[model samples]
Target: MGQGETEKIAGELIRQAVMLLMDRNEDITLSSVLNILADFQMRAFNTGQLNACIQAIADVSAAKSGSLREESALKDKVAGKCSSCRSSDNVTTLH
Candidate 1:
């Protein structure tokens, strides 16, 4: 899929996910995300849409003018940050 189409799908997914979350009584959960992804996926055996969604996320993260870039900068500017993010960065995948 083209970048534009990917972006549109991403936007729609985000909108739906936020609504899904708001309808829930819990603090946070990935169930909504999973539900939305299940719909976006192609055949049960094909992960093409999921992979495209990942690429779409990376594209937005790499953009110079997006909220992600702004969030990154804000994260760096904060002092005495928690270790959750740092710990996540330290994760090592066994090959």
Candidate 2:
């Protein structure tokens, strides 16, 4: 395939992967998401192409780190709180 074809395929794969993650409400971890993208790339293109696609995805998603951190913190806070405890003094925050 030509460079244009390779890039097209890679873009489609990345799009599908992103949509899957969004549908599942999955955390956008680069390593984990790259694994999925790499699998598709390996089948659709060369290893080099796979690496390039992953890099592109990482670049686009890098700004989302702060949002992910906030979401994780909220989840942790919810999980750590006890429903039976009403007073802050009776509840201990887990670090």
Each model's total of backbone clashes: 0, 0
Clashing pairs in 2: none
Local lDDT at 68 for model 2: 86
- Kindly report which residue stretches of model 2 are placed more than 4 angstroms away from their true locations once superposed: 41-95
Name the top TM-score candidate. 2
Model 2, position 60, has a per-residue lDDT of: 41
lDDT of 1 by residue, 24-93 (tens): 8544334445454455554224354566556444543445246566666556545334334564444343
What is the overall TM-score of model 1 with all chains considered together? 0.38
lDDT measured at residue 21 in model 1 versus the true structure, 0 to 100: 64
Global lDDT for candidate 2? 0.64
lDDT of 2 by residue, 4-90 (tens): 665675567667777778888997566556667766656655666766575556644563576687677767566765445665456
